[model samples]
Target: MGGKSSAPQVVLADDNSPTPSLPPSTSDDPTTSTASQQTTSTEPSAQLRPSDRTENLATDRTSNPSSSVQNENAAPVHTNQLQLPQGTQSSRRRRREASPANSREAQDRPSFDSLGPQGETTDEPLPKRRRRDHMMRLEGDNSNTNGGPRPFTNGSAADNLTSKSLNGLSKAVPAVNGSETINGHAKKTDAESSAYFGHDREEVSRLLIQALSDLGYSSSADALVQESGYDLESPTVAAFRNAVLQGEWADAELLLFGDRDGSEDEGTGKNNGQGLVLAEGAQKNDMRFWLRQQKFLELLEARDTGRALMVLRTELTPVYQNVHKLHFLSSLIMCPSTEELMIKAEWDGAHGQSRHILLSELSKCLSPSLMVPEHRLAVLLDQVKQSRIANCLYHNTEVSSSLYSDHRCDRENFPLEVAAELHQHTSEIWFIAFSHDGTRLVSCGAEGTALIWDMQTLQVIHTLSHTLPEHTQGVCFASWSPDDSMLITCSMDRYARLWDTETGQILRQLSRFEEPVSSCAWAPDGQSFVTGCLYKERNLCQWNLNGEMVYDWGRPHRIQAIALSNDGSLLVATDTENHLHVYNFTTRELEYEMDFKVRLTSVSFTKDSNYILISKIDGEIRLFSIENRKSIRTFAGQKPGKFVIRSVFGGADESFVISGSDDGYVFIWHKENGSIVEKLEGHRPGCCNSVSWNPKNPRMFATAGDDQRVRIWCNQTASAPVLHRRHRSTLSGPGPV
Candidate 1:
């Protein structure tokens, strides 16, 4: 369906006609003269005009009236009012050719060519235009002049800028200050601030989950495991743990060994459910013995003496080779009642309930990856809290939560308050020492009595005194041998005696020295010991286990304190003349000697034997590198003088130094930096003669003082504000000048 359209009409103007003549221009300017002559001829110029279609297109583009027009043969024109494509001439060229010299438009017109390529007639300078286009690309604006997409150089530039700004703002903000402040409120430099806090989230979560499950908070632990996405506990192990908790001994054993068959006899070793098939040879034997032993204990608790005897004779007796453990179990069989059995076995509870503790202990035999620890989260948290208390310097409160983790503890758990204030000693207790096993504690006092305490009961088990045919004067120091079977005590009467810990009898008496033995230390090997005298002769002597003197070194000044290294390779001794000497004990040669202005009260070597710690009368404790012969660090705050204030390295890695002060306070300092961690207050207003950290229990330590009481310091339950007592003497005197 097409309709014929009429042909468009076209009109043409004559181009060869004579132009009208005009008067000559009077202007002297060549530009004006040339323009006037061109207009006077009255003939049409050769310059081309836009076609009617182009004029119509320009008119229709009224919204963007300044847009450049495209011509067929010439470059696109650019003007102050319109932007054009690159390689185009300015619109000034068209205006100058179209207007007469004598007209007002001609007088105002400018020639762009004469002004060079950087002409004022252009929309913008070439450099500025290029910069604007570049910024647009960075902003992700890809549209071009022709309404087409253009490629971008950096699409993420804006995002990068935003991130940098946010980072700068976060760093500019100051950290909070006050009680909630951490890291000791110490200002950190840029380098320190940039350090990464290398915390493993998965490992922490796993430990927390294990801790929670062990503490009987199964629901909480389950919830945590679900939220943390950490599947640390296996269903098999969970079933085994549940069986143990429910007192299903046989079922628990089957789960541990992955043996579901329960066809084995109860007491015969012929079939014991294959006994943890995955366990190694030695470990499997140990596990089988432990499991059978536990079964025997359960039978005895149930009053099935017949079955218990069968288990002891056939199952347990054949595999359980530990003589002491076998004897203990055999003795349990003779208990007249469950109460007697519980008492003899040291059970925490009665009968069935007590079996839980046994089962818990046996659980330790399993690999940690296979079973949750028998200890509760609360207990493990208590240990962590206690460790922080022991390691922290300047800790003022009676109890504190761990600064590194969420573990918390009270005094009852570790014993911040005196659990048992020993009044057995008639005079001030001079020294207190815990046996290596932590089962017994020995305290010597000015009353010439040495009391041995049962740590479990906190009761005096034995009262060793001059009445026992030992020393005539008060005992000055006491130390337990490495084996914890024997004890050595030195007295003001100039004798050092070795005593049998179990029988509370004197084994042997050391030969009398010219002066009182002020200090004594047991060698790590347990076969030898060292002693320092207080006055005349000033002898440092090494004695054998039988109390026979083996080696002796004479000194001009009285020995104030002495220590034997853990390996027994080095001996450190401080004298009254403020001199510290280190000796290679095996070679019997002096390694180094250091002199101080103030008298050195005590000296001890680090566990590694690389450094020596010296306590001075000037209220200072100094750490010196043995090889470098230079002071590594200095600790202050405790008022030391007029008494031998022994400072000891303690904590998990010997990371802290604990010492007693004359102001009746116990001070703990960080060994590396010498920062005061905690200042404990429990003793009465006098000197805390000595402080001893329990070798077996890092959380438990004892401080004896002039208060005539041995105060057991542990983690207190209450977070009571520690009463910080300022020693006026410490402030008034010059410390180490």
Candidate 2:
């Protein structure tokens, strides 16, 4: 971005400047007529004196009158009149404060001392209104500053002054607390109030600096850091970061970890006289792994498999012993092309990011010393957001948290009131579920009927009644296919029927079981489904969509409620004997099992498949982790002693446990603590059977009860809510088995 110059630096040298003369020549010819005629002021002392820092700018004398004259006008900016914003102490302010300066009237213009190449007076207009002025700015001459690639000429000072500015900042560490005052701000406390937990003044300043940079206030961050004398990183680390982003891994590694003796030695700090020693122990290995992982992935992207293999063996492999991860990394080489390898590896490669994401990951293991975590301020703000969400008991909506004030969701935002009611079922609704895409709702009625209602119209679009007269008394539980085009229903008449949801016609029927199929769960691919019977000797079986049994569990168990994780990894089933079995979906092997004191009535898997929600026959709901194989949190107080009251995980991030109760109220509890947030009392006086939260609509849900009514609910306080018709039925639930 800084490569091209719109105009040469010598163009501005003619403004109020004299002919070329060395500093000695200026003193010798004190009364030159041309020097006197060219300038308004008569101070050869201030005008011709070269900057102490810029003495290194040009070591050799040049005959070009343009550059030599520009060098004389490269006078030091009047630092005394240089007003910095509040809460900032210039890093060089103390050192230069004792240094004298000429009168403001004698000086031609404000100094570009903060930023600007030597001998160049930036014509940037003085800002009229600015809260805080940054001392330096990364100047790009055109509109294409953010676009296109600009080669870094590391050797040149005129090419992108950022590295040079940051170097000045890092070297000039302001004096500590005591009698030393910085700029006019107190050295004891940088930011005014007891913010940031009343941390070290420099720490808070650095955080603000980092936050400003993260917020795209690069100039402001630079100003605050240079003026406040607080640096976010050593210049070496900054260069290292730049190198990593630019795909210079060797330089970054050299800067960060550095080369040491074979044992890695005791003296590792500031190795090669650059960057801090980030960590010791496993953290160091993790840092190495992250750096090398990026390097390996990028190498693969470049199709440099040979170097990748070398890095894999000599670098990554020694850090991590995970064979599976190594195998996966190794398998990327087998990919036919670079694009294919990235797809399989799920990496965006160096081009897409090669950015701050790695910094974010690496920051998790890093202390806030050498490198501040990526988006540190955003992380802090999110912490505030989470606190606001957590304290707001009825937090329901996925609306983004506000930054100006303490985020608070009004209780009115919660979906507690019923929006609409449906009466298509002839008897009490045994089970109800929203389609995978949430365009339709399927409610199975005890009268051997299943109805599919359009979510848009809030009306019955298809009526799914049993084809055989003998199986007409059932239709208890229903599960939707992954595509939502078909569904399988568990019938009390000892049959499981798959139906075309759109046509409301039976697609396939499984009547091989001697007992009624009580529960069903579909695979993620919808190619097969697992069904369970409460009494059959070989109760659990997986059946293809064509009605053929593909595999059987072989072990007979009285399965009551069954569920498969959305990831299609685990199959969880609860039996009537108060036992729950978790099996690997690929292998019919039981992964984990839990014996409980009460019979589990229903089970629901979290979208992540890491945890499951189980409803009990004892009016209790418990959340269990599959890996732990035990209940982590138990939510009690719902009346389900006789009937199966299904509870499912819903709400934002599935953070709430929602269940239907015999008391006819829908109970919602916080998943983290099992504390009741709301007890929705809207259903007619009878036991509520099932609740189906609209997968597509977080604000709306449907509940089926013994009152034979399927009521749709939404965030009542919403403006107009979702406009839909209401219908109710008069009936009761089936008797206990």
What lDDT would each prediction earn against the true structure? 0.58, 0.63
Q: What TM-scores do the predictions have?
A: 0.44, 0.67
| Model 1 collision count | 18
Query: In terms of TM-score, how similar is model 1 to the real structure?
Result: 0.44
Q: What is the lDDT of residue 369 in candidate 2?
A: 51
lDDT (10s digit) by residue, model 1, range 620-684: 98898888889999989986568877787775467678888888888887775678767778575
Off by over 4 Å in 2: 1-200, 246-250, 258-282, 293-360, 418-421, 437-439, 455-458, 535-538, 587-589, 627-630, 652-655, 680-685, 714-724, 727-737
- Evaluate model 1: give its lDDT: 0.58
